[model samples]
Target: MNNSSKAVVSFIVGAAVGVAVGYFLNSDKKDELVGKLRYQADKLKDKWKKKKDQFEDALENELA
Candidate 1:
């Protein structure tokens, strides 16, 4: 297989392993886990937004 095909196969296998691990080690504190994950995701979103704005501002400054 080519590079693209190899990458796709690797991703599928990794995803399958991750699912199996999550299934077997199911956490009892489901709500808490989900909440923490959501909180982290929001924080990441904020960081990305800040970086995007900075990049846009720098580009505008360079042009002007």
Candidate 2:
């Protein structure tokens, strides 16, 4: 698959795994667990977005 598609799939899979682990670890503190997960996910998403933009810019430059 292409780089963008692969990144999306990887993010989805990572999110699923994170949710499962959080649920198992904090069965009674679901809100807290979800909040932490959301924060981490957001940070990861921002990092990925920056990386993707950089990659695209490089590719465009290469083509140009």
Candidate 3:
């Protein structure tokens, strides 16, 4: 929501997109790389979900 937070999210999304594009263009062993990327992405999503909830709660407390 805030500028800094927005910037961070934008950077992350941009990096992921860039990596995906590179991976598609460069990968020879597609299946193995896809599996690894999926696993890593899932891990990141889980971590992000935990942190996002914490940030929301903190923001709510600040507002309250």
Candidate 4:
């Protein structure tokens, strides 16, 4: 993409992040939101690790 397009995308992402931060800072349920986010992140991490291990096992079997 062109420089202008990159700049626009960056600005949009920064604005979105700023808005989310402002919401969390002002909201009373910040702890709940954080807890949910952490739970989801952990779930995703576990899934990724499982998939990675499965892939490695398959590769090892194929090589052997």
TM-score (C-alpha, index-matched) for candidate 3: 0.50
lDDT winner between candidates 1 and 4: 4
Clashes (backbone N, CA, C under 3 Å), per candidate, total 0, 0, 0, 0
Tens-place lDDT per residue, model 4, 32-64, is: 888999999999999999999999999999999
Clash count, predicted structure 3: 0
| Ranking of predictions according to TM-score | 4, 1, 2, 3
- Candidate 2: tens digits of C-alpha lDDT, residues 14-56: 9999999977787878778789999999999999999999999
Task: Compute the lDDT for candidate 2.
Answer: 0.94
TM-score of each: 0.58, 0.54, 0.50, 0.63
- Model 2 residue 49 distance off true place after TM-score fit, in angstroms: 0.7
The candidate scoring highest on lDDT is: 4
Question: What is each predicted model's overall lDDT from 0 to 1?
Answer: 0.93, 0.94, 0.94, 0.97
Against the true structure, candidate 1 has what lDDT? 0.93
* Candidate with maximal TM-score: 4
Output candidate 4 Cα RMSD.
6.1
State in Å the error of residue 62, model 3. 1.6
Question: Which ranges of candidate 2 are over 4 A from the true structure?
Answer: 1-28
Question: Sorted by lDDT, highest first, which candidate order results?
Answer: 4, 3, 2, 1
Per residue, candidate 3 scores C-alpha lDDT tens digits across 1-64 of 9999999999999999999988777878787878899999999999999999999999999999
